[model samples]
Each structure stands twice: as C-alpha cells, then as structure tokens.
Target: MAKFFGNLNAVLVGGLAVLIVIMFGLHSAVLGESIYPNQLFRYLHVLCGIMWIGLLYYLNFVQVPTMPSMPDELKPAISGHIAPRVLFWFRWAAAFTVLTGLIVAHLSGYLVEALTFQPGVVLIGIGMWMALIMAFNVWFIIWPAQKKILGIVEASADEKAAAAPRALIASRTNTLLSIPMLYCMVTQNALGV
Candidate 1:
C-alpha cells in the first residue's frame, strides 16, 4: 500500500480504477452507457478543474508566500525542481478543464446560448468566460513567463527579472478571478443566479 501510494503514477491509475469500479457499482443511478459523452466530459471537467485550481491555490497560498523566507540555497530546490513540474500539471490541467468544459457545454446543447450570455445561462457564461481567461493566462502568460523565471528558456538577466513579476501578477489575477469563477460555477444552476 505504501509503495503504491508512493508512486504518483500508480496512485493516480489506482484511484481512477477505483472510481470506475464505484461508478459501475452504482449502475442504477449512473446508467453509464446512456450518459456517455455528457457525463464523461462533465466528470473530466470537474476533475481537471480541481487539479487546476488546487495548483493555483498551492502556488498562491503556499509557494509564492513562502519563497521570500526560504534560504537562497533551498530556493533552488523549489524553483528548479518543484515549480517546473507543478507548472506542467497546472498548465495542462487548465487546458483540459477548458477543453472538457467546452465539450460538456456543447454536448448539452447550450454552447452558443451560454457563450452569448443568454438569460438562463448568464451566470455560467460569466464563469466560463472567467475560466477561459484564466486558462489563457495559465498557458500564454503564466507558462511563458515561468519558463523564463525558472530558466527553462534562456533569457537575458533583464528578461528573467521581468518575467518573475509578470508571472506573479498573472497568477495573482487568476487567484482573484477564481473566487467569482467558483461562485458562479456552484451557484449558477443551484440558485438560478
């Protein structure tokens, strides 16, 4: 058990297998085949969203704040090793979240109406737009800047100096946007907001 849990790839695959089993076990409620694309995409969206936002919070709440206080030598461990890997997952999760969300929206037949901010879907549309913007920030803004900041790309000293603040501000902007994004996602359907 410890060995399995210690291997992230194994853990993720095992967890997914368990989830599939549980879903199949609830056959009466799930009717898995009948709800294939829509349900599957929605599930993927939520799963990707959790990973995206979870990393965002980890960066904002834990990593960024803690960096300034770390010893310079220790900082390399995070900046060189951890940040790159985390950003890899972060950016891909952001992309997948948007992709799966669009798939779910299209499959449910409201992609146009929602994007147009039609009355019933205004809140979700707002959330979707916010998420799209955040994803853009993750991919185009944050990742590029992070590459420079983390030395994944060769940058002039001046460029590296510029990159850090750029990445930080974009990440902070996403963090701020996440609050309302989450609110809209949860409240849109439930409260008819």
Candidate 2:
C-alpha cells in the first residue's frame, strides 16, 4: 500500500522480509550446502551498513549541501520530516550492523583473532573497530544531537543551535573513518581472510 510504504516501520519490515528470503534461499536445495547463521550474520551486517552509510553519504553529499539554497518552506520537508525518518533508519541500522557483525565474528571464530590483529585478521579487525566506533557515534553522538537540531523533539533554542554543529561534526567524523574502515574490510578479504 502507498501509505504502508510511506511509513518507516513498513520499510524496515520490508528489509527484514528480504533478509528472511535471503536466508531461505541460502538453505534451498539448489544452493548446495546450507549456510551457517554466522554467514547469514555477515550478510546482515553488510546490508545494514550499506543502509546506514548510503544515507550518511546522501545527507552529507546531497541534502545538506543543497539545504541552504532551498526555501524555508521546503526546508521543513527535509529537516522536519524526511531527515527524521531517514535518521531513524540510520541509527537503528548502525546498531544492528554492529551487533550482527560482532556476532558473526564470534561465531566464525574470528573475534579474538581479529581483535588481536593477528596477521591474517588485522585488516578486517581494523575495519571492524572502525565500524564499532562509527556505530557508537551514530547512536550516542549524532542521533541524540540531531533530534534537537531537527526539531524532531522539543529543545531549547540554545540547545537546538548547539546540536547542529555537534551532530555535523560527529557525522563528518564517521564519514572520515568509514573510508579507511572499508578499505581494510576489502583488503582483508582480498588478501585471503
């Protein structure tokens, strides 16, 4: 339904449904061996990370850059409506991505190896740590500050003003860290993790 798709919960439910389908496909006969839950966890982590980072790029690369030029009336649609919705997805995706990533690493017998940055695990470990830090920033620093700045929840005028720069800095920091993190993720695998 139009109204259903328009809502955040609906969109999330849709993603979850897709995840379930992927798990089913992984188990289907034609796929050969059944994939472990840890393998599935890795897929979940990648999926959520994509959602979170993709939106972050959109906000920084497109929306924020364009906001000042837009009319005040148009601004509300973005700041008050669209941004809040996107951020809900952003923050939760960050949390779940981190959660699922850790679970996968542990289940796959890579956690300690990765954390210690053992020879074969170092690159991905770096990526994992970077992701953990980014997730922390998303949940603790950016989202809370954004709630005030975006007027999604009431805040004092002073608080609102303060929140904007704080949120921007945290988001930007995440962007910076993401580059190295992703490189390490790819390199680890490419190097035969």
Candidate 3:
C-alpha cells in the first residue's frame, strides 16, 4: 500500500480505475447507457482546473511568501528543482483545463452561444472568458517569465529581475480571476441557467 501510494503514476491509475468502476456501475444502474462525451469532458475540465488553480494558490499562498525567509543556500532547491516541476504541471494543467472546458461547451451545444455571451449562458460565458484569459496568462506571460526566472532559459541578471515581477503580476491576476470564475461556474448550475 505504501509503495503504491508513494508512486504517483500508480496512485493516479488506481484512482482512475476506481472512478471507472463507480461510473460504470452507477450509469448502468441509473441511466442504462454509456457515459456522455459532455460528461467526460466536464469531469476532465474540473480535474485539470483543480490542478492549475491549486498550484496557483500554492505558489501565491505558500512558496512566494515563504521564499523571502528561506536562506540563500536553501533557495536553489526550490528554484532549481521544485519550481520547475511545479511550473511544468501548472502550465500543462492550465492548457488541459482550457481545452477540456472548450470541448465540454462544444459537446453541450453552447460553444457559439457561450463564446458570444448569449442571454441564457451569460454567467458561464463570463467564466469561460475569464478562464481563457487566465490560461493565456499561464502559457504566454507566466511561462515565459518563469523560464527566465528559474534559469530554464539563459537570461541576464536584468532579464531575470524583470521576469520576477511579470510572472508575479500574471500569477496574481489569474488568482484574482479564479475566484469569480469559480463562482460563475458553480452558481450557473445552481441558478438553473
């Protein structure tokens, strides 16, 4: 159990297997049909969104604040190793979240309406647009800056200095957008809109 739990791939596969079993059982009993594409895409969207936003919150609430007090010698462990890995998951999760969300909207027959902010889908449209902006920040703004800041790309001292604030601003912007974005997403269903 310890070995299985300690291996991330194993744990993820095990969890997915469990989910599949549960889904099949429930769907067979209740719906008497296969899982819908929209439902699958919605689940993927939620899963990826959680990873993206959870990492964003971790960076803002934990790493950023804790970094200042960390000793200089200890900093490399974060910047050189931990940070790069976090950003890897962070950017990809952001990309997948957006992709899955778009697929969900498309499969649900709201792609055009939501993108155009049609009357009935205004809340979800707002959430979708905000998520798009946040994903853009993750890929275009934050990732580039982070490459420089973390020395993944060669950067001059001044370049690294500039990247820090750029990344920080974009990250914080995403964090800010996530609150309303999440609210819109969650409330849209509750409000029956």
Candidate 4:
C-alpha cells in the first residue's frame, strides 16, 4: 500500500478507481446522468478553472514573490523542476477549462445566446471571453516563455533571462483579469446580466 501510494501515477489512478467504484456502489451506475450535459460540463469547467487559477495564484502570489530572496542554488529547483511540472498542469488546465466552458454553453443551447451579445447573456459572455483570453495567453505566451525560463528545453543563458520577465508580465495580466472574471462569472447569472 505504501509503495503504491508513493508513486504519483499509481496513487492518482488508484484513487480515481476507488472513487468510481464507490460512486457506482453507493448510487447510480453513471454519476452524472442526472444533470444536463451542460451542467456537468460547467461543473467540470469550474473544477479545471480552480486548478488553473489556483496554480496561477501559487505562481504569482507565492513562488515568484519568494524567489528573489532565496539562495541561488535553491532557485534552480523552482526554475527547473517545480515550475516545469506545475506549468504542465497550469496550461493544460486552462485549455480544458476554456474548451469545456465553450462546449457547456453550446450544450446548454446558449452558445449563440452567449456570443451574440443578447442583453441577458452578454455579461456571462464577458467572463467567458476573459477566461478565453487568459487561457490563450497561458498556452501561447506564458508557457512558451516559461519553457525557456524554466530550462525544460535548452536555451542560452541570455535567452532564459529574457524570457523570465516576459513570462512574469503575462502572468500578472492574468492575475489582473482573474479578479473581474470571477466576479462576472458568478454575478452574471445572479444579477440578471
């Protein structure tokens, strides 16, 4: 048990298997059959968004802020190991979050409603577009820059150094956008657009 738990892939797979088994035995054979596909998709979108934004906050609020004061030797662990791995999750989470969110709107038959700037759905559209832009920046701008900065692939020292600030700025923009994005997503519905 301990050995199985010690391996990340094994633990993740094992835990998911346990969860599925429990859900099947305790309740319905298919867990999500009760909800509309859009509802399920939205729920999953929120889940992925949490991971994406949670890591974003970790990078911006915790890691980057602390890095400058750390010893140079310790810094490489962050730049090389921790960052590359965290970003793998971060960027992919952003991508799925956006993709599923769009699909959810489509599934709900709101894809046109949301995008067409109908008075009722426009606010939600704003939040969706915000998320889309941030995810785009995450996958296209930040990840590429971070690849260089984190040394996941070889780059000249100067190239690495150059990528660092550009990545940070893109991250900062996401942080700024995230605040209003959250507000619009929640209140957009509650407040009647």
Error of 4 at 88 (Å): 0.3
Model 1: per-residue Cα lDDT over 1-193, one tens digit each: 8898899999889999998787777754766465676888898999999999999999999999999999999999998999999999999999999999999889987788888999888898999999999999999999999999899999999999998898999999999999999998888778664
Order of candidate numbers by TM-score, starting with the best:
3, 1, 4, 2
Report the candidate with higher lDDT, 1 versus 4: 1
Candidate order (lDDT): 1, 3, 4, 2
TM-score of each: 0.94, 0.83, 0.94, 0.85
CA lDDT of each candidate? 0.92, 0.85, 0.92, 0.86
Q: Which of the two candidates, 2 or 4, achieves a greater TM-score against the reference?
A: 4
Question: How many residue pairs clash in model 1?
Answer: 0
Query: Candidate 3: where is the Cα deviation over 4 Å?
Result: 29-35
Which residue segments of model 2 deviate by more than 4 Å?
A: 1-26, 29-35
Which model is ahead, 3 or 4, in terms of lDDT?
3
- With candidate 1 superimposed using the best TM-score fit, by how many Å does residue 146's alpha carbon deviate from the native? 0.6
Question: How well is each residue in 16-129 modelled by candidate 4, as lDDT tens digits?
Answer: 898667756874645667454666688789999999999999999999999989999999888778888899999999999888989887886677887777888888888888
Query: Residue by residue across 32-142, what tens digits does model 2's lDDT show?
Result: 444566666777888988998898898889987899899988998898789988999899988888888888889878898998888789888989989988998998889
List pairs with backbone clashes in candidate 4.
none
